[model samples]
Target: MTSRRPLSFWIKWLLLIALVLGIALGVTRALGKRKATSEAARATAESLQKTPTYTLSSTDVVTVQSIELTQTVALSGSVDALQTAAIKARTAGEIQGLSKREGDPVKAGEVVARIDSTEAQARVRQTARQAESAQAQVAIAKRTFDNNQALVRQGFISSTALDTATANLSSAEATHQAALAALDIARKSLADTTLRSPLTGQISARLVQNGERVAIDTRVFDVVDLTGFELEAAIAPADAVAVKVGQTARLTVEGLSEPVQATVARINPSVQAASRSVLVYLRVPALPGMRQGLFAQGHIVIGGVTALAVPVSAVRNDKPQPYVQVVREGAVVHVPLQPGATGLKGTEPMRAVEGLPAGTQLLRAQAGLIREGTAVRLSAPATVSN
Candidate 1:
């Protein structure tokens, strides 16, 4: 630079200074843009922190309280008639006079159907005639034996001849006894042609037509008593230990509006091999419009307890630990919970929980999910138990 430079050289130097100045200006503009972006981001975060995330009403909050809870075990099964009978054919023949159909009322000892009695009647007549003939033979044998006895006493006949007469009389008497037995059997067969209802109930099924021939022991009709009902349920082996006879339950049956009451009637001592469950039978009082095979579900009241609890719907499992959304200083806070037994508080399902003090307010399930530290505004503060 000390030496006088050429014009071209000076022009190159000038171009270099211009390029450096442009670079510096571009970097300064870029830094200002970055600082502006950071300030805008910080402002947005502050605004979100100040505004309420959710507005909760009094109904959306539940309060922890000490309550009397009825502990219950869930159960489900089908409603069945207490007494059921399968009317079967006692003798094989063509079915006749089967006027009873499904839903028809039946009385105990009522004739539900009849089998064709032609063969049975004929057998009875033949056996009766044979019985009469045997009776005459028996009378004749007695007379001969009596005569032999008199002759022997008077010495009108030899002792060997009397012995032979005695043998013949014994044989005739045995024959008459056998004939009478056959006649009684024939009469029973004739009586068996008529089928009668074994219980007072309604017919649930009809297996044969009037003209159909059925074999002995073939099922013909199914009868069920609707005056009393029972629910047959299977309980897990672990839970069966607490279930005892006389325990009460409330069941919601299919197609019925009102909940039906039931009492545990019986529990099987053995566990089922297939499902490893114990069978439990609950007796239900007969109600209008109740039917067999109606599906039912309910809970059995095992015991009761007084403890700090909340509604079951308030507990959430979305986090790594089970927690309930609690309101603290106008902000949503997730409090870890140690859930205990589940029960009912005046028909409202409640769950025993720890890690929260009594009278603490918590969000219900209907509030959905709110992030931790989110601001919450309560329109009206109230204590909702369930």
Candidate 2:
């Protein structure tokens, strides 16, 4: 400090000091700006994370309720007529007069078709002629026997001759009886050539056409009574035990818009050997447009119980334990469920569950999956006008 220095040197030193201070100030301001930016980014990230991710509608959630749950067993099968008959050819002959086709109405004992009766008629005529000839021979033999008896009484003929005449008369009578029986059989064959409907119903099929030769017991047509119908459904042996006659069912029949009502009419006493299933017959009322062979599927209500339940779809199995997503305190909460008996509430399937109180609102199947601790906002339910 005592040494004399040039003014330029001092100016240079002062300028260097000023440059270092400027750099320090610039660095401090840059660090403060970077810290403020980082804090703002963190705040934005937290806000986004805390915000509600899903806004659910009223229909998206289902409320747990104490309901009378109807336990049911699923079934599917074909619809069959309660009364059906296969019209078969009773005699072997050429088919004729078969005017009835499928869907044609037929009454009881109505002649639906006929076979050619030429051979049958000829047989009948031949047997009848034989019977007449035998009858004539019987008359002649009887007259001879009477004459022989008189001659024996007068001592003109031996008793052996009278016995011979009596034997001849008996033989003639037996021949006549045999001829009569043959004639009756031929007549019956002729009658059988005409096919008759066994029941009052509509024709379901025409297996033969006119002029087609058919053998005895050949299926010619199928007749079905459409006044009522039944469904033959095979059920599991475990479920079949609870099934009983007179239980109600609702069936969705193929090609029919409205659900058909059915009743459990009969259950098979024995299990099917091949499938190890039990056959259950459900009686369905005949309605407009009902037809045989229609596919049907439904459930048989076996029993009912009053319990806390939720929709069957509400139960989720994504985790190791079965659980249902519940809404509580405006957040998604997963409640572990001990699923009990499954049943139906009206037409919707509901499942009985424990570990949840009645009136707990739950996320439906349509709500998809929401993360745990995620916020949710449910729309207000619609108000009904009085």
Candidate 3:
């Protein structure tokens, strides 16, 4: 037993190596479990933070639709008649009778007034008697000249006597021609006793009363043709150039319930020095009760064409380009559109844009208050009647 009991150094070394291996294996297992747990906890915290929350309020959106809109113009103007005449007298006489009073309708060639013509009547009769006397004298001269020729051929009268008779006959013929012309003049004077209307019109004014003495070329009646009336307006220097003959325009009176159509008729070439404006004439479409100088406001159509349009407030220039805010599912969408001509003053009905459906609701109120994706409430529906 003493001989076998000699201890081996190799066995002791083997036992030391085994103990070190066992401790290493135990440390590795514990560290692996702790690292995995840390990774799982980190992933769980990151997931909670990634969830998104919506806090903005929302409003319903609408779509754009098309409608027919009437183009209108408003301008200052006065009413005028197309055919206005200052009826005047051609001859001087006393007013004997008035056939037409103010506001009476008259026909062409109808007598409008009568003059006291007692002298004219006497002159006509006197001229007629003188003409008859001249005619009888011409007949006497003709017989005398015939007799003188007969006598000269028969040699019964002296040549000097025949010459004298011929001379007297020529003088009598000249006087008869003068008397005929005088009769014609007297006849015309008699006819001038009645003043007649040259054209069919309404009597607008009367200058002389019955039994009043009037002078030649005196104004007796004023006639006006109301059928051809017009509206006269002063157009600004900026808008005057666009108006032309035959252009369509609209006329609205303060008391009228409906608008009236009109056509461009004339433009004053002379510019007004004070206002730098031109006078424009618009022929009113056949309408009722259009009197002289009725106050009217007309929209002279400066231009025309169908283009894109949107609310005037909807247009915004954020970066030199006009853009509109579109709200979608609580998200803000910026939409930019091409703008057309600057329109007339009013609540701008529509502006030009792209990528919008026919009925998409757009934000129009408090224009500047809207931003990309900002929640909006339509104070009133952004609806436009075409």
How much lDDT does candidate 3 score? 0.72
Per-residue lDDT for 1-386 in model 2, tens only?
Answer: 69898899999999999999999999999999999999999999999877856788878887777889889999999999999999999899999999999889999999999999999999999999999999999999999999999999999989999999999999999999999999999999999999999999999999999989999999999999999899999999999999999999999999989999899999999999999999999999898989999999999989999988888887899999889888898889998887489888888888888878877888888899888788888787511100
Candidate 3, 8: how far from true, in Å? 92
Tens digits of lDDT, candidate 3, 1-386: 46563367778888999999999998999899999999999998997666453332222233455433333344777777887877776668898778677889988888888777898889989988998998898899889888988998999988898888888888888888898899899888878888888877789888888888888888999988777778888877667767789988867765567877788888888999998888888888546776666778858666544444556566667667777666566445777777555443332345545566666665544544454645445444544424
How far in Å is the alpha carbon of 256 misplaced in model 2?
A: 2.5
Best by TM-score: 1
The CA lDDT at 4 in model 2 is 90
The runs of at least 3 residues in candidate 3 whose Cα sits more than 4 Å from the true structure, single-residue gaps closed, are: 1-76, 153-170, 232-242, 253-256, 265-281, 306-377
The alpha-carbon deviation from the true structure for residue 70 of candidate 3, after best TM-score superposition, in angstroms, is: 8.8
- Between candidates 1 and 3, the one scoring higher on lDDT is 1
TM-score for each model: 0.90, 0.83, 0.58
**Comparing candidate 2 with candidate 3, which one achieves the higher TM-score?**
2
